[model samples]
Target: MYDSFRRDGVWPEFDRVDRQLLRAAKVDVAQVAAQIPPDLMATDGPRGVPPRGHDRMRLTVAGIACCEGGREDLDLFFHALRWMAQHEARHYPEPGKTSVKVTRAMLAKALRIPARDAVRLRRLSVLLRDERWGSVGSWRSTDDQDWSVNVGRDVRYFRRVRSTDDFIAATTAWLEPVTVATPAADLPGAASPQSPAEHGSYVDERVFDLVRQSDGARWDCTKLLALLRELDDNYRAGNAYAAHALLRAVMDHIPPLFGETTFAPVANNHPWGKTDGRYMKRLVHFRDQADDVMHRQISRTPCVLTMEDMPARAAVNRFLLGCVSKLA
Candidate 1:
């Protein structure tokens, strides 16, 4: 029976031992018989359907019995358990002694039908714990709940099984690191250095660090990095026109720190006037070059911006880092 559930093989004999094990786990025998079809449980009968649609079905006698005496919502408790079973069947195929541990994030990933929210996942976990369906653990009060079960040994007997350790490792690999979002009002000054090179290096380090620590902040930082690298590569390869166009694209997308204020005033105005003003002027020049390259009526030129435009690139990098730093 264990092997059958773990591997989806033929049904096992529903013998006295199996019944005793279910009884020990506080599972209601009558409920199990009613929820699981007789054909599916029979060893000599024709092949029966899988338990995939059990989620849609109303709580069966077995399901209610499995809920250790707690008043947990039958629908959610069953749904969480079904998700755990499905994950075990698909990811951890080998039979093992250790039970499977499940987390809210794991449930969210598995049941992607409509995408469950954090609140729903939390509620489900609470219900499962209250019902004695599974045990919950956390290192600290503020930490997220972690759930584990001895599927066929602890709360209930099941045909399917998997290792708890393997499940944790797999889930950790799949889930993204959680991060807090930051608002635009918290953004710092876009230009903060005297030397363009120093400013560029500072921005690069901050943006890279943020990318490594945050999942939500990754997209924009990654895009900025890709464009910057391409711009640098094209400039070095003497594809000056391509580099100029990429720089413009980077500037357009790097979420401005100054809200709706135009880039022109920010470049020529105070606060940025010291060193950033000079670089901004160069960036404006490159923008014009990009415009000319895109809209020239005749004599379309190539490789207009050269290594001499490195300062403009530095300026843009600083601006991008300033914007990205606002992300928590």
Candidate 2:
């Protein structure tokens, strides 16, 4: 990406003053001075020295985006993916055939994300393979030795940019993670998670802290933490049945926090927002679905449940908050 801008005479560089200011702000001026294509950084003179001429010392736009894009790793990864599509993708006669074959080694080189980061790679690969998110048509399993994805039809436009502005416009679709619209009952503002694991994220961060700090003085939240962690993992892995079972476990486990033995009383009697109350009713419906999943035998026509059968994160989180507030 930087090379493209450099060739167009639009590479953003720092002047002597800019470097000085960055240094004053405790930025790693020396590190910033290093050039990419690794070979240049190694063969180039001492790190952090601007070239003799002022014209040759511009900061790359890639550097600016990395520092300011909020999610540095993801932003850099997105750029790498875009760069690969634009410059390296192979085109075929059919739609959605513009694709790039990538190995972990290739990704590590392009995005600076280490090939050994299996958890991160797994998370990212799940998103990339999802049609609703990355719009990928197919990919080898993350466990595959040479994992890669076939970019969907959208990549055709993703690579057709005539100028820098066009490139920006083309790739802006990735600026925010895409989510499939749920029913209006979910309350649009309630369950907005920015992470790739789109479901079971409503188990609050404070719950984790509470579990970590668990002692005899109050309650043991370790079981809750385990279930919540599994819930999140199953949801991200698209294991809908396990996720539903774990969610049911979560609802069963937390009732004690409300001084009740079961979730039914809390759902039926707890004070929550009017809309949240409506959603909680949906959660009650979900409990029946959970029963169907747990007790029903497979007949000639089995009743299979999916992620859609789970209640919205909003309802679950609201119920959780009610219990947590009791702790205060």
Candidate 3:
């Protein structure tokens, strides 16, 4: 969308958000530049977001020619991704669809190479360069929902990592690519060819400990409370909750949201003659009636809450009392 004040007056950034997405696709900039058609680059209409850095490939090759890659190969590169996306869209339409991977895997196996390399292995790789690829714009923490998606994986380096700003750095790296061609020295590491024993050793006791932590109920009850608290904070911060997600995300080396584990009940209950308001027996999740024994934190702005929230707060202090009693 283009805007007089915006970068493109007719082609505003968010207007074509999916077009800006770069997950997995032609990683080489020079090759990408050679592959894309001017029509694809032109600000026209709704465009499909391709997997594995497809956004970068789209940008690099959209309207330009490059030093590398013949036009035929470039065309093939675009077609290959189209074919992959078509196969995926037709067969699988939701998150974590296996059809795309399965199709790519079958093709890769027929030719004999790893899956990621299959991207670089295509004839189009010859044309793509490093500089052609870049991130759309700012980083969002919510992108973690698609962390395992093909595009998500390709853009993982751009998401929150060791540094919350890692995504920007990584995107910048791709944007300023010297070449898509890997330096021979970094090739071995980049290729990700792990031998059996080396790979096994990589998953040492530390890894096991981490894996155990996800499903582990072996910790002191106090730690369990800590975990619950963390989940509470996450929900408060606009994240959905499932015990599994909480454990899995926390245990993972890189979690989207970290450093919060405070659990508090959002409802209240009492046993006595009816007081100020209606006395409900069961736990109502987020309803808070200050008029009654039950109190509710007024639903504040900047928070997405459900209408079905229970007003009852957890018996946290009571539970702690139980824990202390057990200790005594």
| lDDT of every model, 2 decimals | 0.46, 0.56, 0.31
Point out the worst 10-residue segment of candidate 2 by lDDT. Answer: 37-46
Clashes of each: 4, 5, 53
lDDT of candidate model 3 versus the reference: 0.31
Worst 10 residues of 3 by lDDT: 194-203
- List where candidate 3 sits over 4 angstroms from the true fold: 1-59, 62-64, 93-104, 107-328
lDDT of 1 by residue, 245-317 (tens): 7767766664354443455654555355456667677776766777765566655554444444444546766
Question: Can you give the TM-score per candidate against the true fold?
Answer: 0.32, 0.43, 0.18
Candidate 1 residue spans exceeding 4 A from truth: 1-222, 255-257, 265-270, 300-313
Q: Compare candidates 2 and 3 on lDDT and give the better one.
A: 2
Among the numbered candidates, top TM-score falls to 2
Ranking by lDDT: 2, 1, 3
Candidate 3, residues 177-270, lDDT tens digits: the string is 5645554457555532221211111112222223233433433334444555554454444333232244333233211112223211211222
Model 2: lDDT equals 0.56
Q: Could you report the Cα RMSD, in angstroms, for every candidate shown?
A: 18.4, 19.4, 22.7
